[model samples]
Target: MEKIHYRGFWRSLNQAWRGLHYVWKTEGHMQFHAFAGVLVLAGAWWFRLARWEWLLLFYAIGSVFLSEVLNTAVELVVDLVQPNFHPLAGMAKDVAAGAVLVTVIQAVIIGIGLFWLPMWRWIGG
Candidate 1:
């Protein structure tokens, strides 16, 4: 195998952006996560979340996005390797999706803990 030369930072950044664009374009779940993330940010801003709360929220959001991207990558690789209907390939895809579900569940728990009270107060008071 030929060794590839190390690209500069900008090229690397562009490649990363391209991967994100590919996921955003091809994956419906990613679009949903992006929309939900936007709503979370809007609510966080509206509530003027504390610094620690912001940190936790950011961590949760990042974890969910990271899990989604990794899940997409896994599914793509599985499909590429096993184009036909293979039980193992299907299991691999399901596991990848399960990872995303787990991440979303955790993030939802965190979001509720962080925002539930503030949202209730903001609406009721």
Candidate 2:
């Protein structure tokens, strides 16, 4: 594993921001994700979930973004290589989309679980 140092934290932040910029630039889906993140973060704040719950939220957000980036890459490569539709190309695109679907579903479940307690308390459940 790569050793992490506080001294390089700013550099790490820059790298992550650049990745976010690329995603926002290339993928329309990322806009929706940014909106969703804001909404979920609001809930997370209200819920006051444990540190581990916040960790889970972060994990879900990162996982979805990673899957989205990969999906974008796959579509770009496949389109460049095979402009004409082919069976395997279709399959590749389908598989990439499937991955995004799976990731989004998982993230939704985690978000709901993370906010459930706060929601219940507010609802007097």
Name the runs in model 2 displaced over 4 angstroms: 1-20
Clashes of each: 0, 0
Taking all chains together, the TM-score of candidate 2 against the true structure is 0.81
lDDT score of model 1?
A: 0.92
- lDDT values for all models: 0.92, 0.88
Candidate 2 residue 46 Cα shift, in angstroms, is 1.5
For this target, which candidate reaches the highest TM-score against the unseen true structure?
A: 1
Per-residue lDDT over 1-125 for candidate 1, one digit per residue giving the tens place of the 0 to 100 score: 97776677679989999999999999988898889998998889989999899899889988999999999999899989999999999999999999999999999999999999998898896
TM-score for all models, in order of appearance: 0.88, 0.81
lDDT of 2 by residue, 1-125 (tens): 98879769988999888876887898999788878878887788877778999899989988888899889889889999999989999999999989999999999999888787789889999
For candidate 2, what is the total of clashing residue pairs? 0
Indicate the TM-score of model 1: 0.88
